[model samples]
Target: MAAPARPYRIGTGAGFSSDRLGPALDLVRDGRLDCLVLECLGERTVAFAHRDKRADPAKGYNAHLEKRLKQLLPLCRAKGTRIITNMGAANPRAAALKTVEIARALGLTGLKVACIEGDDVSAIVPMSTPLYDEPGTLADVGLQLVGMNAYLGADAVLPALEAGADVVIGGRLADPSMFLAPLMHHFGWRADDAALAGAGTLVGHLMECGMQVTGGYFADPGVKEVDRLADCGFPIAEVAADGTAVITKLEAAGGCVTPATVKEQLLYEVHDPARYLTPDVTADFSRVRVEEIARDRVRVSQASGRERPASLKVTVGFDDGWHGEAGVSYAGPGAQGRGELAARIIEERIRKAHAVAADLRVDVIGASSLFATAGLKAQAAQDVRVHAAMRSRNREDIETLLWEVESLLCCGPAGGGGYRGAITPCVMTKSVLVPREKVRPTLEVMIA
Candidate 1:
């Protein structure tokens, strides 16, 4: 395969579901990218999408998909930049249809929106399947199974790119693979080439989290200060044919891409430097080099990998019911004592008065919430908030828990004020593995 004349430029538009859109818009309009990747699926996020799908048939994709496509699609069309995303959390087909609709509305005729499906293996994966992370089977979860999706690799996305897709979308597409696929397609890197696969995978890993490499999460007030952080820009990868690349951001934008930030994101969530497993490859970052070529530009190279994993991991999501939290603040000289008293009062009242048999916790937020489970004591503070939280299969139990916390404002501790309560649905997740051959990815492109 022949290499392209120049390095490919790709940028991350989003890292998570609620990432900012302005920075992405900046990348598309000014960064001069060939492709933009928006990775927007987490285990719980997919589970929530299932819940939304159950509520409304056309509502399973990313909530920000419309707004993002509305702004990004036109610019991407004008700039000739392709878009790839996993924003199709629970429904890629629906997301594709929505994108096509948005394109039509924007008068972007002949836009090719591709939807990749078949990541979902809920039908094939049995309840007897063992969990990968902990001891237990899917049946042991004892909650309603929402869905399960296998992580699809770059091969799954290659077809859409080859078929000339303007936008590619899928559910549960492996995060790095979205970035890796374009590199593979553009550079004609073979799937069996472990060395090149590892190189492309490294680029994906660094660019997958959007702003993380650009110092979005690297900001520490004094120790790791990032300049103009409020206007932090997303990352751009200038990737060469040999898998060498420069990690950079728009110089006109905020934040800095130093070796420290690159190294921090390199080890982010990585368990082993030599064997970081993904659906695409078992990448080795141990010998990878990070060098500063210039301001806001760090050249990365020497990433290698072994063959891909034999089995693909699946995220099994279950509906765990409701989660409720309520809090009351106490101020003045004895605020910490009052807050502690309020916590105790709510705990006692919920168990006795409500007879609610549920998982519950009460904490003095300002003084001891985080360290209470560690059996450590916190110093006294004049202002404190008593927070009570619980989870239950029954909505009534959550409501009961919230009532007791609010009752503390008038019935128990003195100086208790600022009472607040909220309830939300909860989903639990577990990991399981399936044989590679059993999971297949399918792609279809729709034109607008």
Candidate 2:
């Protein structure tokens, strides 16, 4: 494939699992993008996806996949924009099938949707596998294994693009690689070209989080004020063949893309600036340049790279039982004191009365919740909320915890009102490494 004379334009649709759909639709309808990448999966999200797949084989992909694609497909098809996404979660084939059905229902005849699989390494990894982040083996977790998926890189996605897939969906596709694959495919970038890989990875890393670089997460009202934040737009990357990109958003969209926003996102999840490891390359963003050339447009360049990692990281998902939370707010005089008293009461009830041996936590929000573990305490405020939460392998234990907290409405505290409680299934995740050769990605295109 020859590189186009003009820059290759791409944009992000959804950043996280439940990211707003309006911004994505805005980008697709007007951004003139060659491709739109929807990065929806997170570590815990994949774990929950496995749990979802366990309960119902037809489920497990992103919960909003249908809603996103139902709106995105026709617009993208009409605009001649390809889509690459990791919305497949724990099940790529099913997600692709669902896409086919949606496309058919929309009267999108002969639309090609590629399903990429083989990220699941549940059978490939053993119980004795040592976790990369902690000092424990998989067996040491003592939780039911939900699933294990290796991070598939641009190499795994390139074949589908080569096959002319309009939409490419996969499980555990590396976040950056979703963006990198399209660039490499469009520019005919060699997999071994570490420098190009680094540049592409840089573009991916910046754009993968959608609006983060466009001021959605960068807003600090009265400090780093963003105008019209309620209408914040997703990011767009206009990439040159050499890998430099100008990160910008729609002219009519809200939010500003200044150097600060770009810089914050550049180092968002990077533990090491010189060696940010993705499946595609070891990106070196330490000396990357960020230049705000125009309003709501920043040019990022000088990102370099070394060889890719020898092993691919695998996210091991486990069924972590249930999590319950209940909160009661208080206001006016002595509100802080009442909230703190409520927190203590709930703690005692869960620990002593219920005798539930779970990981229980109580916090007096507006007083000392966010920084409680850091030993930082805030002065008492007139408005406060007593929040109690717990996690347990047994559903009954979680229920008891919730019940005891709700009982505070009458049993304890002077004015405990505005009570809210919820119970949700939980999932835990761990990282492990596997030889890259062991995980083989397979691609199949389904037409609708």
Candidate 3:
């Protein structure tokens, strides 16, 4: 006889803050969910991680994630709810150790914790390469590789579960893997199960950003009384055996889970509705349907998926060159005219100084037809505010532009008093894009 289906109820907790763990723990303690997913990374988070790694490699892992996890791990163990998260941005091994230490501190022994590695691509970014092949340009233009993390797939999580891991952590795994891991663990779904994979992909997309899927990003006109902006709830999926799930959230949580919210989240960050790519599978978003089942619940079903490719594309950045931007804002009456005059005066000052301000372009905002190429409509208004910005290849040129800008405030326009504040200098950084073929994934099994 086969084991009965272990239908799982999944929910995502608030991100990066230890304060959120209390409420999250309450849900788990109440037996509301079997797994907790957390998302705490973005472009800005990666940038911060880069800075921290430069300052101290030991501090590179997101500290906030550890703090919150520490508070929730004990509760998860008590409630039998496993944890999976993407807190391991630049350092997975270190993060795993920290989680183990937290579990040990809580007196939980034989707790297996796994770290999924091989996502970093900091060293091998090619000098001239785009993120996608020809006809699909959005290459890593000047985006310096502070760090590279591949979105690992669901297959990686099964090993941790097989090893009896109470909690599995990874760095830069696909957003959907957090949800897919539980399904793979329970249903024993193969990687090629298109329908099951599609269900997992849909679940991941719905809860990847936690609150955003529930109602935080919901823009429906029917939900007038619901306070979307305050105390918004994160999404939770009660997945059944037949590759179907009902999306809901914590009771009394402040967000609505209407079809509109689910629809908007389905469309978030998606380029094509037909084929949504992920490391585990290529999900067909068009086949999925969202139905408003109740006041705060929605049913997602009929999702289909395609097979995943063998090799995963990893995003790596390298040092290419340097670039910087500086700007000054002008406000009040006749601001447009004064801004134009100030730009001319600043350019003249740089020319007079014989400074090598290469590409020292100046512009007056709030002026009619100034940015026609950018498709910005020119509108007439009194007391308009103008913003002038300049970009350069080196810090020296930016410094020269800064000095020239100061001179204009003194002699360019009568109302140049808005420029009296101190000028800040910015560093120029460049990024190089590299392919996944250039980097390899390193897998290791460890006991917690």
Q: After superposition, how far is residue 191 of candidate 2 from its true place, in Å?
A: 0.8
For model 1, the run of ten residues with the poorest summed lDDT: 375-384
Q: List the residue pairs that clash in candidate 2.
A: none
TM-score for all predictions?
A: 0.97, 0.97, 0.78
lDDT of each: 0.93, 0.93, 0.67
Candidate 1 structure lDDT: 0.93
Once superposed on the true structure, which residue ranges of model 3 sit more than 4 Å away at CA? 1-7, 14-31, 43-51, 104-110, 121-131, 134-147, 219-228, 320-374, 377-393, 400-448
lDDT of 1 by residue, 1-448 (tens): 9656798999999999999999999999998999999999988999999989989999899999999999999999999999999999999999999999999999999999999999999989999999997899999989899989999999999999999999999999999999989999998998999888888889999988888999888888979999899999999999999999999999889998999999999988899999988999999999999999999899999999999999999998999889999999988788888888888888888888778889999999888888898987666778898888999889999998878877777797787889899999999999999999999899999999
Model 1 residue runs over 4 Å out of place are 1-4
How well is each residue in 66-161 modelled by candidate 3, as lDDT tens digits?
Answer: 678777877887778888877876777778888888778878787778787777655554445445453332243554445555667777677777
Which structure is stronger by TM-score: 2 or 3? 2
lDDT of 2 by residue, 1-448 (tens): 9655799999999999999999999999999999999999999999888888999999999999999999999999999999999999999989999999999999999999999999999888899999997898999999889899999999999999999999999999999999999999999999999999999999999999988999888877679999889999999999999999999999999998999999999999899999999999999999999998999889999999999999999999888889999888888888888888888888777778878889999999998999999998767688898888889889998888778878888987787788888999888889999999999999999999
lDDT of 3: 0.67
